[model samples]
Target: VALADLGRLPVTFATVDPVALIRNAVWANSRRAKAQSVSVEPGQLPSTTVLVKWDGARIEQLFTALIESSLRYTPAGGRIAL
Candidate 1:
């Protein structure tokens, strides 16, 4: 997922390129369904911020959960991102 801290608060938001996010999610999910492969599509990050307000702790927690889940199911040659 794409991450940005636009609000200047301690918080950072999870902001993905909408089109890339959808494509990546679909590709990752499909791979998991078949060969048990996992991969995260590379994010096309913007030079400027996209999302504004978010909780730092929440974002960390979100990534933690995601990584944990991916580790549990993803096999060799699979990929995940922060």
Candidate 2:
């Protein structure tokens, strides 16, 4: 799923700990594929704002989809970020 889609969700909002989410996404993705590696870095935005609002479960699903997609195309030793 695209970040834009997540942003468009009515129940999703800006997270205070975006880095933690990124870390979790990476870790979860790494567990699913042995040939791929995952990493996350802090990103910057113009300002902190709630672009969308969603529950935690939906966010997890979105991340899972993203990781699966990455694993499909990424070569061994390559990295995927969320």
Candidate 3:
């Protein structure tokens, strides 16, 4: 099933903002952050807009994985800056 879904994965194209994408990913994982006593901070996101065409869903998933992996080693009351 998972293998089949790989071929069907929705690939989308849109102008994506890196900062907003990071912020959205952090917001989406807020619950986990609270539970783990981990704080996610959005650092100096470039004031100059960054535009890239890509699959937003896949990017979100990537951020989720990255955050989750960080949570593994991050102690309580830790912070993650993007």
Candidate 4:
């Protein structure tokens, strides 16, 4: 659902920290992950602020979708480190 409007819209990219984006995405889904007995956490990320030219919102959306998808197949008590 998140990428449904991709091509039709102009993607606005800016300097952003992808690790922070992933962290926020994981935080947003923490409740759902807990309800499903799944653990979602951030994986090894740069200690320093790593900025890349990309669409932060889209990156977050992509991570959210990926985590949600993993939640579907990941067994209960399983861990997912993004």
lDDT (C-alpha, whole model) for all candidates: 0.51, 0.58, 0.82, 0.90
Instruction: Rank by TM-score, highest first.
Output: 4, 3, 2, 1
The TM-score between candidate 2 and the true structure equals 0.51
Per-residue lDDT of model 1, residues 1-82, tens digit only: 2344455445446554444443444454544434555555434655554543454456445545565577577786677653
lDDT of 2 by residue, 1-82 (tens): 4755778645545434444455566667666676444333223533554434445556776777777886788777666655
Question: Where is the poorest 10-residue window by lDDT in model 2?
Answer: 37-46
Instruction: List the candidates' TM-scores in order.
Output: 0.41, 0.51, 0.79, 0.87
Per-residue lDDT tens digits for candidate 3, residues 7-30, read 876678888887778888899887
C-alpha root-mean-square deviation, each candidate: 10.2, 6.6, 2.5, 2.3
Tens-digit per-residue lDDT, 1-82, candidate 4 = 4455565655789999887898999999999999999999998887887689999998898999999999999999999999
Question: What's the true lDDT of residue 28 in model 4?
Answer: 96
Tell me the number of clashing residue pairs for each predicted model. 0, 6, 0, 0
Q: Ten consecutive residues with minimal summed lDDT in candidate 1?
A: 16-25
Q: How much lDDT does candidate 2 score?
A: 0.58
- Pairs in steric clash, model 2: 11-53, 11-54, 12-52, 12-53, 12-54, 13-52
Q: How much is 7 displaced in model 2, in angstroms?
A: 19
List the candidate 3 regions with Cα displacement exceeding 4 Å: 1-8
